[model samples]
Target: MGNAIHDNDSQMLYLKKRLNMFLEVLESVDPESTNLDDIDRMIEMVDDLEVKVHQFKKSE
Candidate 1:
């Protein structure tokens, strides 16, 4: 039980860190010069975040 709790805490921390990184990238974007690749990258980030959330749910 204790190990499971520790795993959960670690996973949450990782997700939080990833989320902050995604937010930072978004904040740095310049909409005026944005292109297909930029949009694709953002979408990929969101998809990765979603996958991580689903994985966390399954672990619980």
Candidate 2:
């Protein structure tokens, strides 16, 4: 049980880190010349991370 809890915590931390990185990338993109493809990819990554976080919570 302790291991499971620890693993869950680690997963949450990783998700948060990934989300922050994605946000940073999004912020770095210039509004006047942002690539739609890059935005789409980042959005997908955020969605994927969200799903993983949700799954981790459910498992807990």
Candidate 3:
């Protein structure tokens, strides 16, 4: 039980870090020069995050 809790905590930390990275990238983006590829990359990041979230939940 303790190990499971620790694993969950680690997963949460990883998720938090990933989210922060996404936010940092978003904040650094310049709207005036933003292109389709940038938008696609951001969408991909969100999708990856969503997948990790689901995986974390399933593990619990």
Give the winner by lDDT: 3
For residues 6-54, could you state the per-residue lDDT of candidate 2 as single tens digits?
Answer: 4766887777788888888888888888788987988898898888778
Residue-level error in angstroms, candidate 2, position 8: 2.7
- Give the candidate number with the greatest TM-score: 3
TM-score of 1: 0.86
lDDT of each: 0.86, 0.78, 0.89
Write one digit per residue (lDDT tens) for candidate 3, span 1-60: 133423787999888988999999999999999999999999999999999898889888
Comparing 2 with 3 on TM-score, the higher-scoring candidate is 3
The window of 10 residues in a row where model 2 has the poorest summed lDDT is 1-10
| Model 3 regions more than 4 Å off | 1-6
How displaced is residue 56 in candidate 2, in Å? 0.6
Off by over 4 Å in 1: 1-6
Clashing pairs in 2: none
Worst lDDT 10-window in candidate 1: 1-10
Window of ten residues with lowest summed lDDT in model 3: 1-10
Q: Estimate, for each residue in 1-60, the C-alpha lDDT of model 1 and write its tens digit.
A: 133423788989878988999999999999999999999999999999999888888888
